[model samples]
Target: MIYILYAVLYGLHIAIPFSIRTEWTVLIVIALLRAVLKLGEQRTNHYIAFTLLAIIRDRVFQALRRLCPTKLEGRDKGDLISLITSDVELLEVFYVHTISPICIAFLVELIMVIFIGSYYWSLGLLALAAFVCVGVILPVIISKRSGNLGDELRADNGELATYMLESIRGLDETIQYGGGEKRLQNLTKKTIELSEKQSRLNKLTGVNLALANTFILFFDIAMLALSSVLYSRGDIGFDGLLIPLVALMSSFGPVTALANLGTTLQATVASGARVLAVIDEEPEIEDITGKKEIDFSGASLENVTFSYGGDTVLNNLSLTFPENKIIGIVGRSGCGKSILLKLLMRFWRANTGKVSVSDVSVEEINTANLCDMESYMTQETQLFKDTIAGNIRIGRLDASQEEIEDACKKASIHDFIMTLPKGYETKVGELGETLSGGERQRIGLARAFLHDAPFMLLDEPTSNLDSLNEAVILRSLKEEAQDKTVILVSHRISTVRIADEVIGMDEGRVS
Candidate 1:
């Protein structure tokens, strides 16, 4: 439409001397309308792009939750972060620019061809050929030449990100071991490699752009020459020649936009594929929904065998704990103590036999019910960058201030917290770095306490605490054991001495 308006105004300006002023006024109106439409198109495109980005991020988060701990174990954290952040953001190019432009290019090309061809069928055919070559043929050729370079480049970028993250995280270790220089060199090498890959992709993009421009130039010359020849041959008049030529020349805008996306689309395609992979991944443990909730009367693992990779972690492990008993699990480092706790929590599925609570296999228990019935605390407490109160409230989001304080008191950290300047309002730095190891452990214990589940699994709950703090926490555990089933895992024999029953594991078997 813009091209047609321009051609009419041009014809009027040249052919009608008296109506030149009117032609100028009409051109100004058309220009203003086009600008308004352009602005609206941009706003709509942005709205769609942003909305899709938010949805994509949410889907990625859901995928992460589903794959967590089990399927995501040992996965690259940095790469996953990249996928959720920059890679997903890269899709805005396709959503906003590529999709609409492709459609617009086709539609505009059809309109331009029909209108121009009305003047001369031969000129219309020429215009159609130019659109196809620029919009379709060039993109296909560029994509073929790019091949898997986009995938490789994206993979390299992810790898570099992972390496940088690891280096930063282990910076202290690197400095202490005099490996900083080596790490720097490794990083430099990876950075250079990424740059080289990026450079190659840029070169391909440049080539595609150059070829597209050359084709446009060729088509422009061909259209002008053909129009002139037809006019001289008397098949068409000067108006027919000039108008269609100008329209065809100006109508390459939409197709050119699409032609420019050829190389960039490769990265978008790669990122989309990565995003879909995570969303489609089958979790290691599928949550069974719509099952009857198990009452936490007692729990047992019957002849359960489990393995990690090729190494057996639990071998025919049979154990039972009755309700309202504090069961202590003691083992050396890799003797399946933590693994046993995970099996009970159903973080992993046992290879054989049954892990059951209340005579029902864990596989049949509804996930939400199982979560409500059990609370597991790891040896290393994970705390976010949030207020002390906020971190504790994670266990029970609706817990009252009194409940939080009560749980902290049970963990024997309430007095210390009160002594702090902020008194529970203090922000724990990232990963609870602002607090002592023992303080973080206590906070984790407080979380488990606040959860108030029927069963609690504590792994090295007091490993960082002094004897006095450890004793206080153990005493509280004993007091809580009157109603709650406690599965206490620790390396210290003294820690389990207060338990109603104790089990020892060695080399994946009962010792």
Candidate 2:
């Protein structure tokens, strides 16, 4: 397309001097058609590129999700958010704009160089060598210089984003303690680091681009002079001189734009590496592929031992909880009570021995099916910024409105919810900030009840409630445990008093 366009435009420019070789009407019509065709080609290429990007986006997200189970632990949420949102988005530029255009430009430039060489071999060689220096050598050198800076900038940006998010979440605490100034000072420090790294990256990019422009300009002048000399010496014809000049001038636009795209390309490279980091992470535990479904008749652990780093949390642990009975596990702080709950949920596999439910190995159970068989509540309850009814409905997504209210009533939070201005429709605010700690725990309990699973695992269910509220919630739990296997972990003696069996655990061992 470019070849034909250049040929026609230059032909018209040269032919117009001698009483117009072709009629003006025909030339105008051809020029208009070429313009329209070029526009159509650009739009079509853009559409095709965008379609390819849309397809790749799904695969990228899936890869990130599959890597999540392993990547989540000890990770900063704000950093992950930045990676998924900003860093990943940068790749779209590379996919939709950079990839195809770079290839097309390279092929176009190569063809122009060859055609120019056919006419004026010496001049074409000069242009070809200059193109290589600008397109290949210069870009590689700039990338090496800016690559590390880009990575540093991205890392700093992720950290700054994380800190900002953390600060926002803890704003109330900072205000309460009159630590706003201190927090601001810390944030200022992060901002400074981010600014410094960003400035360095910008400077590097600017220097490389400036150098490329200078080199391109020098080559342009040199090529024009060389072509003029060859023409003056009768070494090349007027057509040869003018055609190569026009071709070089027209084709240099593509490579010049490519040179300017370097900064984004470098950033894209860094983003790609960051994305691959998450995609390549190995999960702590491997899922069982050929495992049968779990039987929730009873749950037991046999000779189990586990540790994090050098600290042993569970060792030679063995216990059994008969089906349809409330089994309480009580221990002091740091006694691995919550860790036991995690093990039951298969969040972490035991280092040795076996954990089984209804005589089927927990390690061998399918994760999705295992989750369907039990409802596990964490100590620190998490709630979305949604209505009370919506939060409760998460326990059983298909639960009717009546069922949600019933579960809330069972958890002893329905009365308080009704007294609120919006009742069950009120937004909980971020992480249930509108509700008290006790309210959040009850909400979690409501979820467990709505889940209607065969087994319920509660980790400190009454940790946040007042004595009256605690007693009411415990009574509700006791009633629910009648037909379900309840594995309870708590530090409060009153909380465990309702359990049918209370097992004492210390330093990861059953006592």
Candidate 3:
């Protein structure tokens, strides 16, 4: 409008030969004001986008926390990574650029129509049709043609990520088995499939852009031709003919933005669906909260029936462990030794039976209290890429350096750590891959030891250790047995030799 005014005022000066200094001053002021408002609009839009992204990310992480260990089993790590990172990021475009752009396009065209109508009503209707075609009708058609492509694209991307992650994690195995070529071929196949899906979506984007520009060009020519005819007819003044034509030409900016949104929002639509799925999902087992804290005593399970969907893993299982005792549970592979420990931890609810802790049902205990009372160690200890001290501190976040060293000494890892150049300050690998299996296992034991809970669940704690280190760790367990009740689970006879009473199992029952 300011440019239109400038054109009008300059035209008047050319015709009337009068000083138009005041009109020029007013136009300059309005132009500067519009620039300031535009800058503010950009900042505000992005501020809203980033703020919303943060809230969404927080909700996604909370949802994952509620679904973890149990519900997350067998889920591809790559899919979760893609959903949390790229998927969440793509939504920024929708918030910052999509919603308001559609509204602005509509309003800008509407106002342009009105301004053109003041010149002639027919010209106003023509402008409306042109705007609708390029902004609304064309984009809607393109989106319909690209129906569900967004979902497929996101899903395929996740699959490729999962495959790549698997390949990388199992690279050692692949090389050992000479399966590297096979894995590479599979990787290539997945990459090609993902690329094909992306290519199809890109083709649609190209078509939409090309057609949008063509429609815009055609509209400009149509408006110019019609206005010239009207000028010859003298139904509208020279100002109406020229000014309305310029307005129509320049006003496609907002509509063009709408046209681009249809193409860019493809990934965002799929991303939004994936993100919302996590947030909206109900956890299989909700965390127990707001209960009175319970002191650790003895723990047991009776008549428990559980399955991993199809076949029963633990059926009609029963066991008991007394306080201040090192009780051993032994079973062959495919038996329920690990699952039994997990149930006691309340990672999974038994289909039909009571898993009790401190003579109270675990389901009735406060999660925080249970965590405080029990230090559960899994077979493979997960460590983040951090200093060795940092990893060990995870067992007790507030544990002191002295406590950490003491715990590591108990696990027979302190001597090895001291031999390192940085000692406890040395950084480990992502997933602790930089360390030997024995080192990682000992670190996990150090964590459990540092926790110093009354009830300890150690699964294959010394599986990676030599006889000397194993004896040292077992002796440490015996020393702690005076203050802690330990469930020492392993198939190794040496591991169970330290137990006060060893329980033997054939299936899920005490045999």
Candidate 4:
């Protein structure tokens, strides 16, 4: 449209023959309108891009939450971080710059061909061929030749991210063991490999750009030659020849945007594939819903069998726990002490027989209800970076400050907490690293106490505590069990001495 307007001002003044004043005014108005429209187009594109990226991130996080503790058990944390950060970021380029231009280019090119074809059919055909070759054929050829390089590059980048994350986390360990030199060398080697992969992709991008430009140039010359022959033969006038030739030359803007995408789209495409893979993976265990809610009375595993791959962790082991009793389980390491508790929690499905709570199969109980009835504390308590009171409140989010202190007292950590300068408000640092192992363990116990559930699964709960603190906790557990069933697992015979009945597990079964 701009090209046509320019021609009218320069030479086609005879055709419109309005006043020269009117023509100039119209030209200025249209130019201003075009600038306004272009700005709006960009604004709209970015808004859409931002909204879509937000939605994509939300879906990724939701999928992660659902797949967790089972499907994501072995996934690399750094790789997951890469997907959330860099992979999604790569797509911002596609959404903001890539999608709209392709649509605009096709529309503009199609209209131009039709207008030129009205004057002469062969000229239309020539223009059509030029647009298709540069916009379609070249990209397909380049993408095919680049096969799998994009995926490989993204994977290597993720591995490099993982290595760097590990290095930062183990910085203290590395210095203590005098392995900094070896660690540095490994870091350099991994980084160099990543650079080489990226270099190959960049080389492919350069080749694509060169070929795209070549195709455009070759077609431009062909357009001029064909239009010149028709003009000389009197089949079309000078206006017909000049207008189409100019339009074709100026019209490469949209297709040019596409041609350059060869630079960023490879990574974008690879990132998209990786992101989609996470969303598509099936969860190992779906949450049990729509079942009758269960109240904890007593729970048992009946002729239950379970395994981790080929290694059987529990072999048709059956046990019963009476309500309101502290039943102790003692075993060597890896003798299925923890695994038995997991079955009762339904973290893993039994291979055979029924694991029951309230005499109903665990599979037939509502997942939320089951969780509500049991408070299971693992051997290693996981604490976030939060204040002492804040971390304990996770057991019952609405607990009062006094209630928090009460639970801490029962866990035998209230005196230690009071001795600290900040008392209950003291920070635990990352993963509770600022506190001793026993302190962290007591916090876990505090959380469990605050929960006040009908069933408790305590896995090596007193492992880190001194015997004095351990005895205090056991006495508290004895008092607390009047209304809750407790499964106390430990390797220490002294730790289980407070229980009503003690059982031994040897090689995945009762002895």
Q: List lDDT for all candidates, in order.
A: 0.87, 0.80, 0.87, 0.85
Per-model TM values vs. the true structure: 0.93, 0.90, 0.94, 0.92
Clash count for each candidate, listed in order shown: 0, 0, 0, 0
**Rank list by TM-score:** 3, 1, 4, 2
* Candidate 1 steric clashes: 0
lDDT of 4: 0.85
Report the C-alpha lDDT of model 3 over 297-343, residue by residue, as the tens digit.
89998899888888788879878889999999898887888988889
Worst 10 residues of 4 by lDDT: 9-18
Superposition-based RMSD of candidate 2 using all C-alpha atoms, in angstroms: 3.3
lDDT of 4 by residue, 1-511 (tens): 6445444646754343355676677778878988998999899998999899999999898888778767787787878888999898888878888889888888988998897776688999998998888877776677677777876777787787778778898999999999999989998998888888888888888888888888888888998899899999998876767777777887877887777665566768888888899988887666889987767889998988888889998988999998999999998889898879888888878999899999999888988888889998978998878888999999999999999999999999999999988998888774346688999999999999998899999999999999999988998999989888999998788899989999999888899
User: Higher TM-score: candidate 3 or 4?
Assistant: 3
Q: State in Å the error of residue 312, model 1.
A: 2.1
Candidate 3 CA-lDDT value = 0.87
lDDT of 2 by residue, 77-101 (tens): 7777777777767777776567766
Where model 4 places Cα greater than 4 Å from the true spot, the runs are: 4-26, 430-432
lDDT of 1 at 57: 90
